[model samples]
Target: MLWLDLEGAVNVRDVGGIPTDDGEKITRGRLLRSDNLQNLSPADVTYLVDHVRLSTVVDLRSPAEVAAEGPAPLTRLGHITHVNHSLLPEHGFDATAEALLVRRKREEERFPGDPSCAHYLGYVEERPDSIVAALRAVNRSPGAALVHCAAGKDRTGVVVAFALTVAGARREDVIRDYAATGERLHLILDRLRSSPTYASSVDSVPEDHHRPRAETMEAFLEQVDKRHGGVLGVLGSNGFTDDELDALRRRLRT
Candidate 1:
């Protein structure tokens, strides 16, 4: 896990240098995952544009979240390609936060184990097209692709996990990358709490709700294997062609 050390986002990291099954590593700076980019400082902008050379922004945030937050600093810039792929159905974006929470509670009740994992499975079942679109956006990026949602743990994690798995990354390496976000939970939660759009959504929530657990990601991958067959199976069923999948692997792996 290569931390980017950005001033605005606390959970930003390059999903690179992880050893794959066949001994190659995912290329650094090709794929990045992070929290929101709405508060990027001027220096942060310079670092991302000049040093990171980020060319694509795969925003996994809902339409409501984007509308509520308005344009991020990078979105204001003309150079970067912005792709919107909300992992929820179209009507889902219209739901109120209370409604969203109720839906989450219902998912937890239905799944009966890890609430986070259950919600992730919902993401798979509900709007797989958006997830596939996000992956294709990453594959199409001319330079580093920064994939993000509000907190960048759940949505980003699920998408990145798919990409890494498709690229033949080891399961342990995938779980390690997902678990790395727990190290910055406080900073991530604080950033979210500072935002008017997310502060209320997180207030009074349990600590476990905010933190990423390895077990959650472990279970998610297992479900991906059992339920969807695998990354290739999931993406293929969602209309990702063999060429695009190959392009994705080539873009991320060395």
Candidate 2:
């Protein structure tokens, strides 16, 4: 969506620098999106941590995935503070059919506002506080922070979209960012499967469960637009202000 196709790594890059409908660029490095870092090679992690100055990590996977995958590696790093905003319930998305069967309209209702989107409405409603939480955490550290879900799509995408929208990225631009995950996901899925954590998972997430596919994002994209009239409506509905959002975008982008 936002990120043009780049090689070398998946789920890496700033959500800023991408131009919005209003013609402003989102800048770069303020918002890094990706699949879980649990599978990153030491070298990749080192590069991101050292160069990007990774300061905080947001894990958006379900609790079942976390217990199965274990804590993300970055959490244990020197001074990084790890936060989990588990979006899906224990056996959710992995079994989309069942999720839909049980929560059909639930998923539909959460967008544009919280306590609705079947999987993550609650978090969206409460995330301005999380944004402030991240700001406080970064205040205690030095560099960048990363936001992720199992496949770096969906839950993580919504949060990334939320942050960018608040930061002044246009609504369409935010949708583009959410769409970019599909391209990035291909690069990392195989490596993630090799991790010891997956082997021990009782609630083993299937291959399809990870990675943000274009179709899935599209579904939410349409929903968000229809439900909230794009970024302004949904976020405004959530209580983030124009001035406060600008402050966040400026600080993160620069």
Candidate 3:
């Protein structure tokens, strides 16, 4: 029942208190999800380090976004960034300027952004190797861990969805978990959409930042199913061993 709500941290929530399909509840405070900590206030930082005691932070943003976050402690920084292209849009202004958000596979196929759906599909076909490596690194922990991306929406969603599925959540339940991100994050997204950096991050007008449509989120989930054949299917196909999955189940589900 422990939850930490740091004022400056967006989308911060414990994955505990949620139940698995077998009627087991996910232990709270163990696995957490959050938006970037770039603007964390002193109080927010203090609360994370002292109150919630998050000793590990698995940052899934790219190196550039990592730089933007100022400095990361060497000890707690997990190298699990960019593990999946499952639910994320194309990165930043590149996605918006060229309207390539949904054409992520092409971008991945090219090792850069592109608009063709085929190339994007090709790219997704080759992502399993890197993703497995990323996951292995960040899954270790003795304290609370926060996994995040810049916006904590797409990439973060995929991982969270995967975890939920492994913990025995149904696809719909996994998706429901992903969609919960918007609950307290509207204000933060609004602020970012209006910030000076907004112009550089997106091509759309700040006014259009209204809210993420349910359809939009649904599309990402659909991609996961269509592309990966389902979360566990994708995980197994991607080289996640049975033992590793067992570890995840043990560590993540209570």
Clashes of each: 0, 15, 3
| Comparison by lDDT, 2 against 3, better one | 3
**Clash pairs detected, candidate 3:** 105-120, 106-119, 106-120
The pairs that clash in candidate 1 are: none
C-alpha TM-scores of all predictions: 0.95, 0.68, 0.73
- C-alpha local distance difference test of each model: 0.89, 0.58, 0.59
- TM-score, predicted candidate 2 vs. hidden true structure: 0.68
User: How high is the lDDT of residue 160 in model 1?
Assistant: 92
- Kindly give the stretch of ten consecutive residues in candidate 2 with the minimal lDDT sum: 1-10
Which candidate number has the best TM-score? 1
Tens-digit per-residue lDDT, 1-254, candidate 3 = 23457666667778787777887787777678777666677777667777776766666665445544456432333532223222233353234534654455445554332222333233245455544554564466667767776666656665666676677765555656766766655655754655454435544445345333345445555665676686566778878889988887887775
Which structure is stronger by TM-score: 1 or 2?
Answer: 1
Q: After superposing candidate 3, which stretches have Cα over 4 Å from the reference?
A: 1-3, 72-126, 194-199, 202-223
Candidate 2 stretches with Cα past 4 Å from truth are: 1-9, 89-100, 104-142, 188-222, 225-243
Question: Model 1, poorest ten-residue lDDT window?
Answer: 88-97
Name the TM-score of candidate 3: 0.73
